[model samples]
Target chain A: SAVISQKPSRDICQRGTSLTIQCQVDSQVTMMFWYRQQPGQSLTLIATANQGSEATYESGFVIDKFPISRPNLTFSTLTVSNMSPEDSSIYLCSVGRDFTEAFFGQGTRLTVV
Target chain B: QQQVKQSPQSLIVQKGGISIINCAYENTAFDYFPWYQQFPGKGPALLIAIRPDVSEKKEGRFTISFNKSAKQFSLHIMDSQPGDSATYFCAATMGDAGNMLTFGGGTRLMVKP
Candidate 1:
């Protein structure tokens, strides 16, 4: 199991602004993922962040909207760009070690007003 | 299309009773199945997992039953307790896919005392 720490547990952002969430892992990992969980809904994978490479994004999400930075094996960041009401959701960071199971951070709750 | 389907968007179980949640996947390439538990204001945590080679995996009070031919799996919680009340999600990922998980619609379980 990995210990993940995410910042800004809850925040209120104005529309058209951007919020960047950070994820730090206690142990080095090869794969870090960003996810969005809408209220009362399932989680949707936003992108896969690998150290020293461009993040691979899923359909319906793009780098322009959710720019990701994985500077090293233990740290990553996800920025919600040009926020809107629909962008309000809980953003999660997860790390996969050995492809067996993934460990998750506490999550960041963003409310775009 | 939703790659994974889950039943019973919400569930209510009496304390000490059994709680069951079912999930089915359409992608045959998915070889890993994991169950996640999330509480309010927290990210989803991996509860239990199973592989295609295994029929069942049990950890403490939680068990995962896998039917490879049916492309289905289920999670069973025995002796439900109020502390177990939370949102549960079923997810699948293909081996070597960087562990990018495709998640099912979540089930909110409430265990009453």
Candidate 2:
């Protein structure tokens, strides 16, 4: 199992500010993903961070809002740009090697005020 | 479009009893099904998983029952304890999809002592 470490476990940001959450994995992985969990809601996929390539955003999500960066197999970052009250949610990073269970980071709880 | 659907938004189970959560998916392309457990202020952890070819998979007190024909799966927790109280989510993914997962609306389980 891979061990993932996410920074900024919790944060409070102004409505117009942007925050970048980092994720570091103890081991190399083939795929990395980012998800959002709103209060009392299910986890939603934000994007697939491909190393050396642009992230693939899911429907209803775009790069302008959630920019993701995967510099290597062991690290990735997600930036919530132009935040708003609706942007408050828990951001999570996940890493996987193959067709197996993926490991998740502790998650970053962002509260936009 | 919500590809995955879950039932029983919340449930309460007595200690030593059984806790069950159900999920269904519309996409047959999903070949991997996994359940996750999450406590407040933390990331979700993979609990148990099963493939489409398997009818059931059990690990200790956790079990996953999969019905490929019905496109449904369920998680069962035996000998439930107070510590078992947490939010559970069911997710599905396709191997070729770069491990992108589709998650169901999580179920909050509260095991009373």
Winner by DockQ: 1
How well docked is model 2, in DockQ terms? 0.71
The alpha-carbon RMSD values of the candidates against the true structure, listed in the order shown, are 1.1, 1.1
Best by lDDT: 1
Each candidate's DockQ: 0.73, 0.71
Model 2 lDDT per residue over B37-63, tens place = 999988999988899998999999999
Tell me the lDDT of candidate 2. Answer: 0.91
lDDT of 2 by residue, A18-102 (tens): 9999999998887899999998898999998989889888899999999898999899999999999999999999988675688
**C-alpha lDDT values of all predictions:** 0.93, 0.91
